[model samples]
Target chain A: MSDLNNMTAAESAATKAAVMNQVPGPEIEGQSPLHHADLASLAKQGPKTSGVHLRELKLLGHLTLRCNPANADQLAAVERVLGVALPLQPLTSSENGNYSIRWMSPDEWLILVPGLETFDIETKFRDEMPGHYSLVNSSGGSTVLELSGENVVELLKKATPIDLHAKSFPVGKVVSTLLAKSTATIRRTGDQRFELVIRRSFSDYIWLWIQDASLEFGLVVEA
Target chain B: MLHIYCPHCGEYREEEEFHCAGQAHIARPLEPEACSDQEWGEYLFFRKNPRGLHHELWVHAAGCRKFFNMTRDTQSYEIKEVYKIGEQPSVVAE
Candidate 1:
């Protein structure tokens, strides 16, 4: 096996892996995980204001980047591509406009970008990144949801066991925890707004769960 | 459910998010082919079921998904300390 620690730039460049553009052309329209849920119609027909508000962020790029944190060169390459340093702090997240990076673990980060920019970002990582690393595009595997309003906390408390107080989960904090019975990578985007990155398979279950939980508080679906 | 601290996430999460992966620090034989049947069976099947303080491997399945070593008192069900992988537990069984 080649020594990853001492690999020269030329050696790293030669070890390029095949990367495919998963995003299709404009002719082939993409669909969000909850497309079947018909949220757009509900946004218009549903109550204008309620205790809890739910919106599907929909069709964003989800990339999982795994690299060595100890390797300064690898870290620099990531900064060059993303234009922001990786949030090495545990449970922290950093964002640059449409691009948001969440610290998933010590050596792993989940990068979210606009749907159309997914392929471009992946290509940038391939050309810029060096040494032993893995960047996987999983946009098709999951979807995003934005929940807010006065009773958002009350609705979330019934589903997840995580402490949602401002003291523990302040803004810009990200935690991958159980959302109801399924897993969700939740980020506190605002004081009241939270972004949940949930699996595509569990989207139906969670949608129903959220609807049921928000019943007492009142549910407002937005497009 | 137990309140377990995930060393990677640096926070306490409910026990449902974690899974106890049996004993910790089980070293595989350097030369498995050289070992006899009795030695191989002992290495594979035998485990230490200590009554007091125990070192256990646990994975934060629903959170950061990282494995860490947890020192716990099996009788009292108290987690003494949670440390990252590759680090020796300070509270070893006496």
Candidate 2:
């Protein structure tokens, strides 16, 4: 029954922002937006081989960090917290094992960590980060979808207007752009693979979009 | 559709990804209390609708979400140049 200010540190009473653990107890269940889609059943029954493969990497920690890129202290503090330097270059991403950082804008980034580590990371940022910065735990707001296979590029091209050519968009490049009418933060993970960070509310729409668009190339559902 | 360059992203994205915020470089009056009604009215509602070169504020809404200044030809719909927010446009009306 922890309310809003339950997690504020006593040492820095006046200036600290309250951080809350959004995850519930073991008795409760935390279901992703696509939990009702029954992806597990689709994985088992869907085609084994297809031109495009879709998998929902659901329930991950989605943190939006807003800080000054010119601040050296903030950068070091972030590196200390995430163990990876914030990707300053526009339309780029950096990965440290399970943790991934996407450059959303000049002063903003979207970080994805493991599902259970959102609160831990948020608290760590609060303690270590300096100056004026904001770290919001937006895990429930969005979900990740990993798209791969031979025709993954084709499928994505149909949705987004960004140039998909390898010369223009290499591996690790991230672009927060419009995807099929909805918005998605698209990151290139591999030559044939891309990870799309989509809003939870638009998850069903994107899922339906993928299903409809990939029909020409064939789609395989992976759990 | 127009292909607009986002100075922040350092790339040219489709015009669909951006939104024209309106006229740029509209400095707010420093001393509003010591101003005439006509001056205040002009500052609040007046805007230039030039036929040729126009300086407009545009936002990369779907991309990096950064706002920049764009110098474009109003009649031809040709974007002359794009620059960052704090920087002034190199190509201006003659």
Candidate 3:
């Protein structure tokens, strides 16, 4: 942990919150949460057609923003950077192009963007937004899994207690809940599609859980 | 398993998402320095163990990570209401 507390007054004042480029250079390949699972090989060798399709949206930039939703300036700053307003409604999401924002709580929102665009967005938020707020780059801490197909909901139902019925858990709704034995921030992308943002440490456990749950309905690995 | 309503998430989640945090509305003595040893001991150890209509604290661990109060019936295992922290509960034991 780098301490800003030891810095000189001028240096401290000049410094913005620490933002690093987590994405590795071309020479070094970035590993997805399930990289060790070697899904790429499975995609080529495993069954091509199955009731469930699993894909990892690997190495995306994940930023956790904590600020006052009621503040007009902060909201406008977010809109200016992402070209989409913060989703004020509970359990809702706002998306523009490759950038998507999930309402994590009343005052917290998780923003996902292109891996390379993280620092730029963080800098923009620091320069544009005013008052007390925190923007944390958690890109390395988590990864996303895209689950789709006919039996996707059924597979999720086996692990989580939340109702997967379309009437109850509609599209664009996000919920932070327990998936199997691990925690995940789940969002409904479409009628039969769901996006799971899960911790990197628990990724392997979730992968095993999903594979076990999807065995009844054949699993198709998508790179 | 009990299904708890998280006021922060505005949804009813499984008991796995929550953890019971003992009794609610137990205010600490403001002037701890002025209190005697017996008074401090009473403040630390004394808690009501009622049979019905108890106000207890709970945390939505997996969902919102917010602490809230739940008015529950100990005998029936029924939740009367869920409210956020710092808010008063509507249901009371008479």
- After aligning candidate 1 to the native by TM-score, how far in Å is the CA of A221 from where it should be? 1.2
The list of candidate 2 runs beyond 4 A from truth reads A1-14, A25-27
TM-score of 1: 0.96
Per-residue lDDT tens digits for candidate 2, residues A6-60, read 2333332235677788887546868889999999899999899999999999888
lDDT of 1 by residue, B15-54 (tens): 9999999899999899999999998998899998988798
Q: Report per-candidate DockQ.
A: 0.91, 0.87, 0.79
Task: Please identify model 3 stretches exceeding 4 Å from their true place.
Answer: A1-15, A24-27
Tens-digit lDDT track for model 3 on A22-112?
Answer: 6656578788889899999998899988889999999899999998888786788789989999999888898999999999988999999
Chain A (alone) TM-scores for all candidate structures: 0.95, 0.92, 0.91
Q: List each model's interface RMSD.
A: 0.5, 0.6, 0.9
For every model shown, what is its TM-score relative to the native structure?
0.96, 0.94, 0.92
lDDT of 2 at B28: 90
Best by DockQ: 1
